[model samples]
Target: MHINPYGEDPVRLALDLINDPPGSASELGRRCAAAGLVIDVPPGAADLAETNRFLAAWLGVVDAPDETARAERLNALLAQAAAYPRLTNHAADGWHLHYRDPDRPLAAALRALISVGTALHLSGRGMHRLGRCAAAGCERPFADLSRTGRQRYCSPACANRDAVRRHRNRTAADHG
Candidate 1:
């Protein structure tokens, strides 16, 4: 039995979707497949729209002002998405637990996966392990799965850019 690390992958997938949303159903399917999700069914236009909506709601949890508010928003998502855990060996993969019903649409499956994964990530890691990038102009969402869990920017480029900006500002202040 292979235990799936639901926490990391789903959160990463959510971030990917948020950062570069799919333009169409086929694009959505391709992106999810590229992200290693099993494409049980070909997603349609409705799925694409639903996924966009779901991501918007998920962002609410990410943007929550406080831990209590974050937990509350996440709980609402879990309530809407998650189901009783069940073991399945779909696609000839080893038995693994699923938090959603079988044969669900792509959007629905993503909803469940992301909600449960976020819960596990928050509980196992830390409540502050997820947020938007700290760069002055980039508010992209990022999951802090780093070894030190101090990830503030979405990418190293953003971090470096912010560092350069701060250094230039300090240099100007000193000159003035």
Candidate 2:
């Protein structure tokens, strides 16, 4: 069965790339493929640099403090990647929805998928679901997919760190 590649996978891939950027186009292609993106192009060095530049811009949207700012930033991305939605079997697993034309290079396809998927994810889930980790000293971006939608940290480690901090404060207050 064809899974929805446009949702969690793309967001996760964006986070992974943002956290640990690829060193080369080949590496970017490899990592993206590992993250469920099907790359058709033999990526060149330029593609890697270009994708990173694009991601930096996208990160601006992720970092936007308000929903209005986020939407404006995302609208710019969507306009840049401009493609009509269509159903296709690009993966050949089965027919599914695509927001891009077929056979585009890895960089272009990523721009479309990541941008649009992020927009959908944020709007469908909640505007507050995407943000930098709330844990002190951790600036990683994350798309919160938690059932309760209250997630603010990038990982369990960060969550635990914040929890410990709060617990320590509470204990100190009690002692005082």
Cα-based TM-score, every candidate:
0.94, 0.91
| C-alpha local distance difference test of each model | 0.91, 0.86
Top candidate, metric TM-score: 1
Off by over 4 Å in 1: 1-4
Model 2 residue pairs with clashes: none
lDDT per residue as tens, model 1, 22-122: 89999999999988788777899999999999999999999999999999999999999968999988968788888998888999999999999999998
lDDT of 2 by residue, 1-176 (tens): 33244677788888889899998888998898887777778788878887898899999988998999999999999999999999887788888888887788888989999988888788777788888899999999998988788988999999999999999999999999
Residue 11 alpha-carbon offset, candidate 2, angstroms:
0.9
Which residue pairs collide in model 1, if any? none
Cα misplacement distance, residue 74 of candidate 1 (Å): 0.5
Position 40, candidate 1: lDDT: 77
